[model samples]
Target: MPFALYLLALAVFVMGTSEFMLAGLLPAIAADLEVTVGTAGLLTSAFAAGMVVGAPATAAFARRWPPRLTLVACLFVFAGCHVAGALTPAFPILLATRVVAALANAGFLAVALSTATALVPPGRKGRALAVVLSGTTIATVAGVPAGALLGTGLGWRATFWAVALLCVPAAFGISRRPAGADDGSAPDLADEVRQLGSPRLVLALLLAALVNGGTFAAFTFLAPVATGVAGLGEAWIAVVLVLFGAGSFLGVVIAGRLSDRRPGLVIGVGGPLLAAGWSALALTAAHPAVFLTLALTQGGLSFAVGSTLITRVLYAATGAPTMGGAYATAALNAGAAAGPALAAAVLATGAGVTAPVWVAVALTAAALAVKFAPWWTGSRRPDPIKRPRL
Candidate 1:
């Protein structure tokens, strides 16, 4: 893998921290901005919405620009948004900043995915992608916790300032292109749009959405399940989250090694096990040992399956390399947004915390069904080995 890939991962680490750290900062933000917690939560929703909308839009608009330029511009905009968010005294301005920041985040991620794959051999795209995405898994384990600690010790705005400063080095690193890092010919917008007409690409996107949706359905409610259902103490919440993050890191690494060569095998074994893990968690969450064990296993299975599906999207969208990452990003964000909302609905029905686990099971099962459907299974897929550069 090229060193530039690591720089992209570093950028992702900063952005991912900003993305996930809000969960811990909402209380402080609500009190400071004089808004209800529920209203403050809308910041997350705004970010997710921006990601879903901005991925393809930004990719299309920046199709003609050099990859490095697009990445650096997005990083600077993202950092600027954080600065604005930190200095803003009013809630509305902060909300607007979140939306803009998310747009930049989406753009950066899309281009980074393309660039990462471009930096590697055709056979190692999966590993390259894993290297880049591991940044997010790492952020979950370290960056988010550190951001929360910063928020607790200083203020919510301090976390924002920290994230902005973190972006500086990454942006500077990405601005300098290493040898062999080519600004490839810009992908034709028409060709990119045309790729969406492929049913395989469409189904791959749906699978990506379902896989992530199932994962988030359970993940978003983990705190309540750990404390109320699993009989774990409040302090153990962090332990379970850290355990899950560790498992996810392992899963992505394993997926990287296998997905390029045996995608079908990775998905085949992982898909059913992922659903079973969710089912087990839903049924046995009352047992602390079982809950904790399943937390790790399920996290691994979720990322392994999700990463494979995402790799499939890239393969299926070989005709639209520039836009392929945007499509995958949009689908994942759509799932991320939809999953928590559906899980919240289940909770609103007074279905108890564990009900979301069943939602996860159902979503995973649906994804499996989609993956194995006659149409998808029978369709001739793109050969990633023969695919062209982005």
Candidate 2:
């Protein structure tokens, strides 16, 4: 892999930390801003909304800009948002900063995905994408935990400051790269937008959404499930989370090696196993040892399937190289939003915390059914890599 790819991953690590660290800081933010915890939670929703909108909007608006310039500008804006957020006293202002920061994060990811693939040969696109996405998994493993510790030791504002400082080095690294690193010409915006109407591409995006939605459905509520259902102590919560993150990092690495050659086999084998793991988790939630082991297994299978589905989306949207990343980003965020919301609804029904695990199982099963439907495998189906002209 190219050295620039590592730099891009570094930037992603900062952004991913900012995005997820809020989960551990909501209480401090709520108390500081004189708001209920539920109200402070809106900050997360705002960020996700921004990501869903920003990925395509920013990517389209900056399509004509130099790739390096777009990346650097997004990083500066992201860092600035953190600075402003750290200084703000009002909850509304902090919420606004989260939205703006997410927008910048989305733009950087959109451009970086295409740029990463551009740095490698066609056959290595999946591996390149995995290298870029590994930053996110690593963020889950290390950055988020460190952010939580920092927030606990200092104030939550300090976490924001730390993220901003981290962005400076990433911005400098990205800026030092030559402008010609991205070899592709700017895509035609009209053609790119039109490709959204492609059935094959749409299906691929849906698959990506389903895979991530299922994963987040369980992940967002893991803490409650571990304590209330599994009878684990508070300290064990972090341990299980770390184990899951470690599994996720391993999953992405394995997908990188296999996805380029056998995407079908990866998804086909991984999807069912992921669903089965979720089912087992729900059934055995009362057993702490079993629950902990299943958490790690599910994490690996979930990311393995999710990563492969994302690779498929890239191939399905081959006609729109620039917009392909935007579409994938949008789909993944949409799933992330929808999954947790649905799980919350299920909990509202007094179905217990384990209900979310069942929701994950259903979602994964639906993805498999959609993926292997007769129509999807029919003779009329087009090759994922060969997008027909719109």
Candidate 3:
């Protein structure tokens, strides 16, 4: 990919770290703000909720801004929110900061995905988007652990400050790019709205949501699954989590290569594989080795669906790439917000932590049905977003 793609990935890394690192800081934040751990956990939910609302709204609102400048503005706003988070005196203010920061993060991701795909040849757009999104996997592998370590040593505030510091370099890298003339043109809002009316596009968005919902429903309860079902020690949990992250990274690379040509194959087979992994976890939880192995496979197959789904949405909303990109983000975040709740509801019924795995299986089955629908298998709509061959 181009140097600019790497810069966009760096921005994604910075923002993704902000999103994932909050889990590790919850205890410290709760203690500092004199709130319960459950309340502190709402910060995570708040961020996801913000992204779900912000993605399409911000894309529509900033449709006329130059892409590079829009990205830079998002970075600065994200950094400012972190700074505010670090200095906030009360819990509500801190919660508000996370929501705003998530808005910036969502806006940046929508624009960055559109820009990255546009920078590449038409056939290479899936690979380009994979490169940009790899930052999230990398963050899971590296940044979140490092942020947790930093939070443990310094303070939660210090971790937020560190995230702010990381944003500076990404912003500078983006600012150096030359602005395009078409970047600031007023987008045809009417046309974009009409494009959103497509059933194919709406189904694609629902697929995105189902994919993430299945993955996260199982993931949110993983700690308990590890301890209660697998009988793993606390230290072993970290190792298992790392294994999952590595699997996710591998999944992205593999999917990037195969999706453009065999998107249908990937979605059709990958969904069932995901369901199977979760089902195996549910059935074989007593076998620690099997549970650990299944965890890695499940993580991989979950992320492996991303490239195909993104490409599908892009094709479905060919008239408005940015709007399509935003729709993807919104769907993913909506799933993120919903998954934990579904898992929690299961656990609330005294079904045990492993209940989530069953929930995951059911959700993945629904996604698989959607993927096999005739409309998705063959959309004859002409590509509206014309591209010059690179």
TM-scores for every predicted model: 0.96, 0.97, 0.94
Comparing 1 and 2 by lDDT, which wins? Answer: 1
Count of clashing residue pairs in every prediction? 0, 0, 0
Q: How far out, in Å, is residue 32 in model 2?
A: 0.8
Error of 3 at 82 (Å): 0.7
Q: Which lDDT values do the candidates have, in the order given? A: 0.89, 0.88, 0.83
In angstroms, the error of model 1 at 9 is 0.6
Which residue segments of model 1 deviate by more than 4 Å? Answer: 179-184, 379-390
Over 4 Å off, model 2: 179-184, 379-390
Considering only N, C-alpha and C atoms within 3 Å, which residue pairs clash in candidate 2?
none
Which candidate do you rate higher for lDDT, 2 or 3? 2
lDDT of 1 by residue, 165-201 (tens): 9999998898876624355576678988899998878
Q: Which candidate order results from sorting by lDDT in descending order? A: 1, 2, 3
10 residues in a row with least lDDT, candidate 3: 381-390
Clashing pairs in 1: none
